[model samples]
Target: MRHSLPGGTLVLHPDELHDGEAGTEAGFRYRMIYVEPVVIQQILGGKPLPFIPTGLSTDPRLGLVLETFMQSIDAPLERLEEEDALFDLAQALDAVGNKRRGRRAYDYQAAERARDYIHASNGASITLDELEYVSGRDRWSLSRDFRALYGTSPYRYITLRRLDLARKMLLGGFNLVDAAMAAGFFDQSHMNRHFMRCYGLSPARWLSMLGRQTCTIVQE
Candidate 1:
């Protein structure tokens, strides 16, 4: 289908059947961000997914949301900035949509306990069953709640926490292998895969950027 996506227009829930093509001979340039539904779920706090009746919206609030999130091609998002943006975007989305009720209530307390457990075990291998025990919820329910509240699966949450620790170690001049091991990854290669997926950069490249960022801070 031929359609125009102006600045600030969003196309959410694009399934496998959807594809895009340029309408003009000059072609189009755009950036696509792939967000896991769990991320939105966390921010929306179990509210049904917001339905934007038409795929296109010129709502200024959503425009601000998109602007806050989309970054330069090679830039890394600071943790706080990303979280704040998601919160605002979620609020805006929730306010615009009609309410729908879920069969089961969202369990914020259990999910929070699981999150705290993950934080405490950042450098250890944790299983779903283990989280189930700690959070006092069944394995399946805990898993679902965790993602609904935290924007990631329990396994992925652990990996991200490890990567955060590894980034700190690397910034402190530790070798990649040591950092990876200390952060609880099985090996450097294992860390490398997850790091790239999370940061859109290899460890070496991220380190290089970190160095430049540090230098800029020192100069300032």
Candidate 2:
């Protein structure tokens, strides 16, 4: 979707199939935060997620709420501060958004249980049957609830969690193959594909950027 999103325009639930391209020969630049859905659910307190339509938004409240969040991409936000900002963001989205109602009630507790299971089983191959058993919900409902509440399916969540471990391992100076195995991935290429999809960069490039960021922080 071609949108002339100004600096303060907010886009929500960006799960659609799309690609970014420069509109003009002069290249463009922008900043984005890839927050997980679980973070939003934590602050929303069992409320259904707000769906802000894709494209430009001129809502003043959203712009103000996003200012602090969008401005501090490079700097780290403390836990409390980040939580507050996310809360404001979710509230603003709800204020200007249409409610997305579904027939099935979203079982937040069940999804949370599944999420805990995923984290606990990090670096291991977990099956949907196991999640079903642990969460006490059927496979389809559990998967739907997971995506609605966490913004991803159980399998993807597992993959992302493993990728998180792989990222930490890599940052700690582990070799690529070793890190992949340690993170429960079958091989380096398999890990590389998921890493690129999640991070928009290869492991090597991500590591290089982290090194540069570290040097910049030290110099500052």
Candidate 3:
């Protein structure tokens, strides 16, 4: 029930329970595409769903196409381009469905405890000693396992969590200064630097784009 998936894995769940846990030591960021059953029926000409025995794949080509499909969602691409990307992704997935590979096992319970503590803190500053106390792992081991499982260091993960909170506040009509402070940043400039580095754009610019997009949708 609590299987650990490595990075670059793709999963397909068809008409079954697909449950996962986050805020754990092995938590990960991922992209998901949902295809309706009607759409699947049309694509398969009313045939049964493709039987992907294991429902998992680590094919590099499939990963590349999946990444392209994800980027097409946000990129300023034409509708046809997006469709092409999706088609390619589907084909790549079909090609890898029958292939099998071994799964890797890992033990990171202490690191998971640290991750849970970090989430519970809710953007507050966390110390290494606190993590050690909560997780029973030394700073070095915690840091190593945390990065291995979550793909980021503990300090970076904390900063990313604050950034996420600040982004949400900004989208919910909070001003820059308020969002920054409430998300645990020292000030607007502090949030600005990290936000720009992470998103490749300033908050003001991103917000402006969002406003324009909303206006366009409303007008249309």
Candidate 4:
């Protein structure tokens, strides 16, 4: 379940999923967006990531900053309100990661096709040969583009995306094997390997860490 939460109740971090039931439960609702940590730094008048002295989100100092942003979504007043909103979002994220003073080193656009193709196919075994067709670049060039743009090869990128989907599904209470299969992994082992690689922890351990219980749904 998810809703915009006045944009005030949001304690979002980049790439973090913010889910909750909306004000009135008309139906199951959700809102999904990627909030990058750098956006926060940008809003702090070009300030770098502040020294919050703690890495955990639950830190009271971090909580205060986040609470300020979430609880005051519509409070800031400015002529250029859009700009203010962007800045506000940045401030919120800066509570987590500091902005890189220099230009960001990642070319996020280069991986669009690769990302789309992977998601479109439900995380199938994506070969460079196939990506060449989808992205209109040769294998060698595609590999280069992926690494140069996203800091990882296409294969690794796909694997990571699969892991992301698996994590989301598991968090939503999907069975591990079913989540793996739905994410285009060959089987549970495939999901486990990628999950471990991406998280440095097993799927079950991840669930425990996240305080999620075993899923009841078993997709056929």
Candidate 5:
């Protein structure tokens, strides 16, 4: 479903196929917070994932909670304060989910197998066809089931894993080029694009911000 959310709107988007476009000529600015399905499951104590019917809201209370959560991330707050902010956001989501809760069954085992194969790859290249073959499910079914179970598509999941590896290698003193290549990117430029998209900054900028030294090649 296509949505054109306005400013100050709170969106409760599910792990489903959806896209957005600019609503007006001036463009729009929004802050997004992505919560993993497992985190929500833990919050709900194993309740089936909740589905928000409309997915768009202008609720001021939810908006305030989201703002607080975002602020807590950047602020030098105590660990308990951060936890309290997170719980507030989770509870807000749970309240919405309770309003229109529903569930759909999918091939859990097949999805699990695909997830396991991706984990075993460890920054190696992966393809949907390979996932299908390993999981004994068709590409479309596997993709749907995987998203249902993991809150992201398979290729996106792979990219996230690669990003994780690249971050670790960078912290371990690997240079940008080596870390990018070793983490399954084509080169530094390729990794830079994804790093910017996912983390809102380039790898070099991120490293410098963290005050981590580079190019030392620490022994693993």
Candidate 6:
């Protein structure tokens, strides 16, 4: 978001789809953080977050904090260290308080409810209107609030959730086909397309490497 987002916000997996813009400005200044959901789960040691903190803004101070935490994630991190990253995040959120002004309470609540529903039905093909109905929100208001609260739209969230599940299945010794099914992808091809963009490798190759790692650990 354009307004200074309060710190301590945790954007969920990349598959989750988030956007950034300057608040209340013409021509919207834009920025985005691109990282894989697998990276986030890796950071969290392969655990799924039913919910992760997020929807922060880009302030100068937040910029520094974000850059530093990002630097530490040279590789997908383990779950234990996620707390370490969160420690730094807590400091940032304390700096930015809740309650974004010029935004209505109903609007904010509707967006949050919609996102929460998406999180609940991750990987399912839920329509935008469905999301709004469950959230007691209209499409236009939900769209804007969804962006502000979760940094992504209903459609994007479903896709990312699918991809995130796929990554987890891969790490769990599921083959490419299984991973795709598990993640709610239509097929290996579908999983492959998203995987290539997010992880820079084919699902088969990723599964192979993961398998080898598991084997090595078992041997040890």
Task: Tell me the spans in candidate 2 whose CA falls farther than 4 Å from its real position.
Answer: 1-102, 212-220
TM-scores vs. true structure, each candidate: 0.50, 0.50, 0.48, 0.46, 0.52, 0.45
Q: Which stretches of candidate 5 lie over 4 Å from their true place?
A: 1-104, 215-220
lDDT tens digits by residue: candidate 6, 65-133: 465346444534323223334433433443443422343454776777777787787676676557668
Query: Which prediction has more favorable TM-score, 4 or 5?
Result: 5
lDDT of 3 by residue, 1-220 (tens): 4353555554665677676667578667777777664444333234445445555665687777676557656654333234434444444555566433234344499989999998998888777768879999755456546767998667678888999998898888888888888898877877887799799998888889888221111112
List, residue by residue over 149-171, the lDDT tens digit for candidate 2.
98856666777888999989887
lDDT at 107, model 5:
97
Could you give me the TM-score of model 4 versus the true structure?
A: 0.46
RMSD of each: 9.5, 12.5, 18.5, 17.6, 12.5, 15.9
Across 140-208, the per-residue lDDT of candidate 1 in tens digits comes to 566556667778666667778999999888888778888888998877767887799788988888877
lDDT of 4 by residue, 1-220 (tens): 3333332333443354534454775654433333455544433544654543232344344444343334335343222223334443454455445534444343345457766786787666655557667777544445545666766555666667778888888888789889988887777866786688677988988898878876534447
- lDDT per model, in order? 0.69, 0.71, 0.67, 0.57, 0.71, 0.56
The better candidate by TM-score, 2 or 3, is 2
Of models 2 and 3, which has the larger lDDT? 2
Stretches of model 3 off by over 4 angstroms after superposition: 1-107, 212-220
- Which residue pairs does candidate 5 place in steric collision? none
Q: Indicate the residue-level lDDT of 174 in model 2.
A: 82
Candidate 6 lDDT at 25 equals 57
